[model samples]
Target: MKKVLFSAALFFTACAVSAQESVVKEAKSAKSDPVKAAQIIEPALTDPSTANDPETWKLAGDFQKSIYDDENMKLYLPGGQADTAKLYNSLAKMFEYYTKCDEVEQAKVQSGELKKPKLRKKLAKTLATVRPQLTNAGSDAYNAGNYANALKFFGLYVDAPQNPLFADEDAVKNDTLTPLIANYAALAANSLKDNAAVIKYATIGKEHKEEGYRSLMCLAEAYGKGETPDSAKWLTTIQEGVEKFPSQEYFIGNLMDYYIQKGKIDEGLAQMDAVLAKNSTPYFMYVKGVLQYEKKDYEGAIATFNQIIAEGKDFVAEAYSKIGDCSFFPAQEIVEENSKLSMDDPKYATNEAKIKELYEKALPFYEKAKEAKPDNRQLWGQYLLNIYWKLDKEKYNALEKELGY
Candidate 1:
């Protein structure tokens, strides 16, 4: 009875080994038919006898790559139409399988199951060759408004340089498109409202030259959002953005808006004062003037703007316009005060004269603003119309005709 039981155990063990070898051989023979080969070998991945074999995972990777290639090749055929969705799906699967194969091989090497990696070079070469396609796939999905998939593909491409498959490749290290792809991934994350992902990618994206400003803007926006917004980080990010890109108004404007929204004008002015102490640029002076204006310290604003004008920088026109606003807003307040009194009131005429005096003060500055930026209607057009109407009707009518009003 003992001998018979031992024979049965031997038969079962032999059958398991035979099943593993038989499936492997049959899968290899059907390699030309990628679909059939994949179907035949699918079970081997989880089969107790073959699950630990690196060769099984490698075969699976090859089948997936073959499926991707077969579908992609249809694009060159005369009447063959390729399904892009299927192509990208297979391509992603190919990458996954290849990554898994590499992991399994490494694990085997570590476990003393193999002397060295035999497939590393081949796998690395294959991954390098196909890496750029991930960018193309991401861009296509982005243009199609598939933000989630676009982020996925772009993330894969962005991370490929650091991937183990490209550990020895210098070309991957110097790839210039990584930063740009990171920008795209950040844009996708922004579209998806994934603030964490936006910060993640935008931090990397902001290192790119041509598109770096946009990434910086996105980073600031992400830092300023969410349930518990980091106001300090948001301000710091905007300040850094302004320092790096002084010509970009978005960063400066956001910085100023934050001060206004949080009623921290004094804090903003102190910081600006500190900045100006080191190197006073006309642009920084203009920001200071605008902050003062928002704080309703019109005299201080006018003084700051006058300093900008004295510097004879490109901000001269903006300085003149802001000065006009200082006088104009005061005149408007006088007009409101006069409206509250009766025409026979003693202070009415006095207030009226003061209003005219302020309008007269504003006239020259508005004229200068118009001369500096003739095409910029926002700077001077409407303000000049009001000033001229109050003080000179004929000039107002003529200017109105010229503006096609």
Candidate 2:
């Protein structure tokens, strides 16, 4: 009877041990299965972020990574919630683990989800909703010295209807986003060297009062910068803008530049004269002087620049430098070239008188400018160089002795 009891006990122990081993194997298998592992690890995601329910929590973590990355991320990270400060913090930590700064991290900060679909429809849609703000942000970016970011925002402003930020913009019956957007669009286009875009945006800007003037600037800058070869087109745009906003000095100045570049010297001069007639800002006069210098009207340029210097408060050393440039480039020599005698001959004495007269006209302006701008190396050098070359031997020798130069 005792031996029978022992056998029964052995059978019971072996059965128990076998059941325990089977349980352990099953647990290992469950842990190895990713889907099951995820479910077992964080079932809250599977039950909540999915599509079957109004609450988007069910598929929150179950998107097919290869196929639905964008979709999943969008679902989890919806637009308004995408780039929150808290969400960004979380994303930053995850990226720090890998020592990388992938756009995915930014998107995660943007969308607030790891399971976001690769296509990112939600973010795009959200972006469309904030179109106006984004456009404004683009302008701000340019103001803040971020050209690339400015271009991006301006692009969104133009294409706002298709973007996620579209709803945030303002549209009117008589005046819509088309014009305002085009203004910013021109600025962006100029920065990016997109000539077509500049034309499109500047046209829109011209529809508005303040922004229109700015748009004209974009047109002028684009042509001046040589990013676009369509100078004629830019000029035409400037003329139209000038006609519409006639009193705007900024637009007039740009128009002057356009005419000069187009080689319409008389028209450019007329424009400058009109501008100067109104109130000769040093800059306008300086530009006029430069135009004269380039056109080989050295005497005319010198006279205009002198008017600026005499005005005292309107101009800077640039005017002085430019005047020196014109005189130093042999304006007197050129007149001598047309004379009837060699410089060393008796007839040349007549030529020398003309040279001295021209030199006298330029000397005091440079000398006075140099004195006023003691720290300006360019002005000082110009004065010294001119003095040494233009004055007679006795006068030059005396001045050099005085200056100890």
Candidate 1, residues 264-369: lDDT per residue as tens digits?
Answer: 9998888678667865788888999999998999989999999988878778999999999998988998999998999999899999899889999999998998
Compute the lDDT for candidate 2. Answer: 0.57
Q: Indicate which candidate wins on lDDT.
A: 1
Off by over 4 Å in 2: 1-129, 136-149, 160-181, 221-228, 241-264, 276-280, 286-307, 316-331, 334-344, 374-380, 390-405
lDDT of 1: 0.85
Residue range 12-90, candidate 2, lDDT tens digits: 8777655544433343355434234333423322222221221222122221111122322553764523332222222
Error of 1 at 36 (Å): 4.8
Residue 302 of model 2: what lDDT? 83
TM-score of candidate 2 on Cα atoms, chains taken together: 0.53
lDDT of 1 at 92: 76
